[model samples]
Target: MFRVLVLILAFVANPSRAAAAPPDVDLELVLAVDTSGSIDIGEARVQRLGYLETLRHPDFINAVKSGYLGRIAIGYFEWGGKVNESSVVAWQVIEDAKDAEAFAAKLEARPIATRHGTSISSAIRFGTRLIETNAYFGARRILDLSGDGFNNTGLPIAVARNDALARGIVINGLVILIRPTVSTVPLERYYAECVIGGPGSFMIPVRNVEDFASAVRQKLLLEVGGLTPSLTAQPAAMHAPVDCRVGEKYPSFVEPAFRN
Candidate 1:
């Protein structure tokens, strides 16, 4: 009787520990989309559509079911500036076309929120928090951050990247380079050096808006299957190494104009 009472008291003291374990999936993916001031309305819409179509793609559904567990968990969020991260969709499992279609519908129905400034660092931290709180456990944790501009606010991105990597999160990036006129260094290079980290982390750059869909499809496959795309398949612009400090240097040229 005393042992039963002690066990009951222990369960009561730590209810979370006694709670049912989260469902296990092959991958826990957080799609952290950028809605910073630089993104603008048309570009933002393109990004949203890119994601929607990718989610609804037959190949993506196949990739989800190819795993041992035959399922993956996903969440969506938008981020910009400090304190502007918003979860667009809660964690959900994807095992078949129906689940993927439902997730796509949610994306289609979401209203976009406009925010100012770019804070990739904050987005990374937000992804980390989502991974920590999600009700599904995945063999792999991946944060897919899509952005067009450098990190201009919040903590340094390298710090956040290192922290997330330390916690076993793989950070990948979809570098939106449609506005090359606004960038001093290649956006893909920025993502490769300062943003993405962890085993098999990679960045896919899309120069033309039309390529967004295919790039996302391929990126999703690579992530879900834990397969690396051939280096030869990478865009020609990424062949040369780039300076990692380019993101840090961007504000020195752009911030003064914003202040004025």
Candidate 2:
């Protein structure tokens, strides 16, 4: 019995018996898609299809292949007022076309849903937690947040964004402009000033329905390659600064009549 106890103690103290280190990857990306009430079933379908196609595209595949580690870890989740476990797709490592296909298939199989509220802050917080807790160490951590409207619930946007940024997570935006909102502030301008940050951060505005897929594909390629678009291709500089707190200050702005 003494010998057995000694053996057990030795095993417990052994470094090798400790939890294994997470794998290293070129990037750890969380695709926080918006499924807020403003996004109708058709729009939700389009968003999902856009991501599915982008994941399988040659350009995105090539970008992943060219990474320093020749691999990336990606996760997908839908967000609105808040997040739930059911809406999150697990992380997957992509090193080749087959891996990418499998990841896309997982997202495709999940049912598209739209929850109430436009809580961009909550999405950012959730994305940060996912990256922090995932089983991979990435050279770069990014949260690619796509949304049609401003944040109307949860913590302040800047607070959540700053927290993520402090932890070295880059936030990029896919600003959907197809829906008209009560705010006169251009969604692109709002995202640029208040949403996106960190190295090589940028936002692409989808002004028309036809541009949705291409915008998503382009953003993914840039993110996978860790490259920022040229100055001319980025959103134009705003002559007037936008009030980042506009959404929170006017909760009524998220009402059905004002939503996209």
Candidate 3:
């Protein structure tokens, strides 16, 4: 199995020995970030800061703590293509404020260059593999997808999305409309209509790059715990998780789970 170890505060708090496993969080969140060539270095910086700022935000911290077990597992990765990509942060379980900040600090310290392609399918595939490896499938599995554009390479989004849903995985979208000459609601429509899926899945578009922080805050609030969408803020219904083992898309995207 592909594995890399890092000191995680949650692991310390709930140590799992060789013969035993720790109690899992009620949710496993996979944050898939876009590092495609389309996103310039400056914009990537803005997107990167959005995550750091969210982790720094007290509201996000509270949201993490608000889970049924007062904790949630999270992993962050950057995907733009099948190769020449890297990990932003590994699978993490934030059981407390300290753990959350540790993740933020790690991201802040990493320096990134722009050379990845827009491969949303591969990103989703990576996310599913990550969650399965965490052994937190029984927990609520969420693949948090953030990107500025549509899927161009690898598998078709609907195919991957439908497969993810069939595996009881919820995929939420954070669609960023960079320097949109017109309005961003249209871009978000693409998300709601195409990219976003799974139970309670919804997309939050950052119309203005300046609004990135706010969008992240709102999305995190809803994504972590089951929070209702705000009608005042482009309200949309959330998608329900699906498992099509015996239905359409059966055995789709479920191979990674088994392989893991």
Candidate 4:
């Protein structure tokens, strides 16, 4: 069944999976982490190591294999003032267990070496270019931007979102909410409304950096398998009400197998 789906998706994608551009990279997903001034070195390590740990877990491997095609392209970058931001991993195509292991190992070995302004736009643009420059076009292309602030530099988010969407890029977000008195609800909404683009885009907010693991898992599941992204971590109070308004926004990608 998975093979058939891969063939179909690959077939619809022009001559061959390798032939397509832009939305290239079978199951491409970018990890856009925050290294802005707000994040101290300890917090940055937590964020970086958190994802490296998640990728090393067996569950992430299973998630990578969840797609009919086991191939996935990934790129990592730090977002901040355009000057402070740069790519951690250029463009990596993980096609199997060894590839995933190597990529995870590399990430684990990489040190936290960025501290600058938090510009979500720079990260988004970097991810978009990574996808556009790749030879592998996956069934899914996602720019997973995790940050604690809204856009403050470079291009405005709306224009960047349009550019990404025009190229069939899905900009899912991982918004880290830490302030007790300050709710990150507005930030998450900003992501959902302005930051992310494409048919099936969503955002998840992590109230605390400690919960980053679970949030990373949830985001990974949704990104690779096309699961419905919702705030399952209910606060004593709900910020975005989960109502019967199902499939109201992201109605494009959803399936039974994807829920895995």
Reference-based TM-score of each model:
0.80, 0.84, 0.76, 0.77
Q: List the lowest-lDDT window of 10 residues for candidate 1.
A: 251-260
lDDT of 1 by residue, 1-260 (tens): 64344334323422443355433677889999888887788878888888888888888888888876789999998987853534468788999999998988888888876688888888888888888677776667899998888887766677677778777678999988887636666676678788998878888888887898888888889999878777766455535566554455233332211110
**Model 3: lDDT of residue 147:** 81
Top lDDT model: 2
Point out where model 1 deviates above 4 Å.
1-23, 83-87, 181-184, 233-260
Residue 122 error for model 3, in Å? 0.8
lDDT of 4 by residue, 134-168 (tens): 66667766788887776666555555667777666
Deviation in Å, model 4, residue 159 alpha carbon = 1.2
lDDT tens digits by residue: candidate 2, 1-260: 64344334223322232234333677889999999999898888988899999999988999999876789999999998887558788999999999999999889889988889998988998898898788777767889999988888877788788878877789999998887676788777789989999878999888887787999999999999879988856576548777788787444333221110
The per-residue C-alpha lDDT of model 1 at residue 48 equals 86
Judging by TM-score, tell me the better candidate of 1 and 2: 2
Q: What's the lDDT for residue 163 in model 3?
A: 65
What is candidate 3's local distance difference test score?
0.68
Candidate 3 similarity to native, TM-score: 0.76
For residues 81-136, write the lDDT of model 3, one tens digit per residue: 55233555776778777899998888787786666556677777777777656755
